[model samples]
Target: MSAEIVVLLVVFVGLLILNVPVAVAIGVSALAMIATLGHVPTAFLMAERMSNGINSFPLLAIPFFVLSGVLMGQGGMARRLMDFAAAMVGRLPGGLAYVNTLSCMLFGAVSGSAAAAVSSIGGFMIPQMKEKGYSKEFAVALTATSATTGLLIPPSNIMIVYAVVSGGVSVAGLFMAGVVPGMLIGFLLMVASAVLMRVGGHSKAGVAQVPRFWPAFFGALPSLLLIFIVLGGILGGVFSPTEASAIAVAYAVVLGGFFYRQLGWADVPKILLIAAKTTSVVMLLIGASQAMSWVLTYENIPQMVSEAMLTLSANPLMVFLLINVLLLLVGTFMDMTPAVLIFTPIFLPVVVELGMHPVHFGIMMIANLCIGLCTPPVGTCLFVGCSVGGTTIARTTLPAIPFFLAMLVGLLLVTYVPWFSMALPGWLNLF
Candidate 1:
């Protein structure tokens, strides 16, 4: 670690401990480093880097995706997806758990926002699970953990962020690459929940009643089609990812307003305001992280850190393990957007040097960070899920353990097994 890196870490950590907002903490730390080094005036560097940070065309996809998620989430999509999931698995032993997991996965696939998934699916499933006799902590844990699979699924805002920061990894390829790994994690979560429920002595009495398969499927069909419209257009080269994002927003409006009749013109202002707020926060984080990345690069921090990690281990597996561990720790403390922004530039060079494909590493990195969203201190989904379930972090921590372990297991597989991340994109010739 260089003196500059030490200063950056100290200031950043100190600000975090003082309860400053994450974006502010990052920007302040970057500014402090510039002042300490006296290499460049703080204002000029901050202005240039921060403005350049959010100047990319690809970033436009983020706001569109966020708006679309808000639209679909409020459009009665969650209940219909729940019905469809229940129709698929609600009669199995410990069915409500399966329903919650499956519904979250479906909602995530369409909505492409993990927080939206947690709020929408958790809002419904947590209460339903409690009524079915599942513990509140377990319900929050399950909802929070399962919701993160969305970030791994297609049309993800975080994937757009990664695509931009990664320099040139195809957005469509990243989207395709994530499909199997995302589903794999969701399946692992479902199995973990089912097995834990069985071990905890939940009887068959908790099984839920679902509507007929055809009705449920047809009801959710409009919401489901948005997935194909957005992903298919991008993959087919009918549009770029940014164009696809706009199309997704259009589709979401049509589905929510006309097709479903759940969303009205009266609801547009609130949805836009919510989307604007989310987008502003995310863009600010990107700008701040960009400044941080620039400072790190100017100080040669990435090269130094990369060299240190490579010195620690010449073996690819060991180096990857070291990176994954660091990312997991970073995830616990930082939000995913800024983490992806700041670390992608630093760690990507090392992985490319090791011969790992950028798309594979992107999936691996996102999957690894998803676990952090369910952990403590700054786990976004954890806090949201707990609030939705009317529970506290302290109460939810124990029950969340198994699912956390399950995500860790999935992350290990994603890290070590290239096939899970590479198969789909390769088949599509997406590279």
Candidate 2:
């Protein structure tokens, strides 16, 4: 590596070790490297790189999705979705666990945020699980793991970031690719919960039984229709992902304010403020990441990394396995957004050289990073779940073991079975 690249890497590590916020760390580190190189005008570089980062049309999807998720989250749509999910699965062994998984899946469809899912769904169900005799640690663990489904499901903001960073790959296609695999992950989690409950000799909670299918079906209809509207619009090409997000916001307003009667006029300002705040944070990160990415490209860092990886493993399978192990380790230390931002450019070319489709790699990468959000030492989703469930990190980590295994299985399936990420997009000719 050149002196600039070496200094850039050092600055990044040093900033991170100092516990600087990720966006600032990235921006400052890039700036430090640029200054050290003294090869470019700082003002010109700053404006150009920042503009390049936020200039994509597809990137407009981020704010819309953020607003839509905020509207649904604030309007109490999650509660209804959880009620429907609980009704459908609440009678089985480890009923609340199943409910947690299913609810996260449903909530993921709408929210596209793991933290939001855990806060809203886990807040409601963890207490219920505890009351039903489920251990507090197990409840927290299940909720944390299931919340990761939000990253896998359609409408994921992280996927939008990946698409933007990956040279304008289809956001709609990525969304479609995520659907089946996301559900599969959720399903496997449920199965794991079932097996774990049986092994631990845990019985049904015996809470007030759900009435029947029809009631549950009707109750969940509004949220289900929201999913159909968003996904159908995207898949059918009726709207771009950005437009689809606008539609989602409108739908959430009607459903929450009018149909479900959960949200009122009084809630509008707070919802807007929340959405705006979230959009600002995400957009700033995107802008800063763009600058850092530009610096990396200018330094030929991606090419160097790709060449190094190729030398390390000529076999494609070995290369992929090695990438997975690296990503898992990175996920443990870094938050998902920065990880995706910093690594996507570096890894995309490596995968392409190994004859992997960008779409497949995108899904696999997102899922792997999603697992990191639940891992220890800095797992954002795990911390959120623990807080919501009123448990400690140590307690929650035990229950996370089985769920982690289930996610690993899903990750391997997506990695090896390319069709899991490609079938729908291929049929639709969306590549």
Candidate 3:
């Protein structure tokens, strides 16, 4: 690596180790590297890059999506989905576990925020699971791991960020691409839960006494309709993903505030405030990551990194494996948004050279990072889940082992089997 690159890494990693905010670490690191190069005024150039970073029309979707998630979560969408899920699978052996998995997947489909799912669904499921004789560790671990499926399902704000940074890869196509892999991850997590139940002697403990399926489904149907509206609107060309996000906010307001009546008019300010805070953090991360990307591109870091990886292995599978391993480690410490923003520019080229579709790579990368959300140190979902469940990370991590393996299995399948990620988008002519 060049001296400038060394300086950037040292500074960035040091700041992160010191618990600095990720956006600040990235901006400072990028600015430091630019200062070393002495080619231009670092502050002026970085300001321009930061301004340009969040200047896209596509990024408007994030705040709306965040708002919608908060609104739905506040209204009782999680409970309705849980009720519907219980009605669907609550009679199976170890049914509460399955209900937890399915409810997270369903909630993820609508809200597209893993942390929101963790907080909403985990709060309810963790206590219920504990009451039903499941361990607190198991409950929190399951909730944290399964919630990541939302990122892979539609209306994902991270996908929007990817589409923006990826320089015109279709948002619709990326949305379509995530469907199967997301479900696959959910299925594998379910399988792992079932296996844990059997091995741990908890198999018959989780049967729930839920209402009839049709009634539960009908009750939850209004909230569920957001999925079809946002995704269908995008796929049908009635609107862009940004417009669909705005529509999702409107629908969430109507469903949560009017139909459900769980979210009172008095709740509006708090929801907006929460959404604004979340959006501000994400937007600042994007802006800083953009400056970092500019520094990387200006220094030809992408080419250098790509060439280095290719030189290590010319075989596509091996190169891809190396990339996955690196990303998995990155995910362990970095939050998903900054990780995606900083790494996409670095690795997209390597995958493209191997003849991988950008849509496929996008899904693969997101799936890989989804696992990170449940890990320690910087796992956002893990922290939220632990908080909701009233457990510690150390307590949850051991129980999370099986689900982690399950997620790894899902990630590998997504990595090797192009069809899993590609088939739906292909069938829809999205590419």
Instruction: Indicate which candidate wins on TM-score.
Output: 3
lDDT of 2 by residue, 1-431 (tens): 58888888898899889999888888888888778768689867876888889998888878888888887888777877877887888777667788888988889778878889999998888898888778888888888889888787887899999999999788878988998899889999988988888887676553466547678778788878877888888878798888888888888888888888888888888988988988887877888899999888988888998999999989989889889999999999899988888899999999999999999999999999989999998899999988888779988887789999999999999999998899988988888
* Candidate-wise lDDT, in order: 0.90, 0.86, 0.92
Model 1 whole-model lDDT (C-alpha atoms): 0.90
Using all chains and alpha carbons, the TM-scores for the candidates as numbered come to 0.97, 0.97, 0.98
RMSD of 3: 1.0
Candidate 3 C-alpha lDDT tens digits along 244-321: 889998999889888888888788889889999999999999999999998999889999989999999899999899
Displacement of the residue 344 alpha carbon in candidate 2, Å: 0.6
Reference-based TM-score, model 2: 0.97
Write model 1 residue lDDT over 1-431, tens digit each, in one string.
67788899999999999999989999999988888887668898889989998999999999999999999998989999999998998888788898889888889878888878999999888888888788999999999999999889887999999998888789999999999999999999988997898888764634456789999999989888888888888877799999999999998998889988989989999999999999999999999998998888888877887898899888999999999999999998888888898899999999999999999999999999999888998999999998888999999999999999899999999999999999999999999
Candidate 1 steric clashes:
0
Q: What stretches of model 2 exceed 4 Å from their correct place? A: none
Error of 2 at 248 (Å): 1.1
Model 1 ranges with Cα > 4 A deviation: 1-3, 203-207
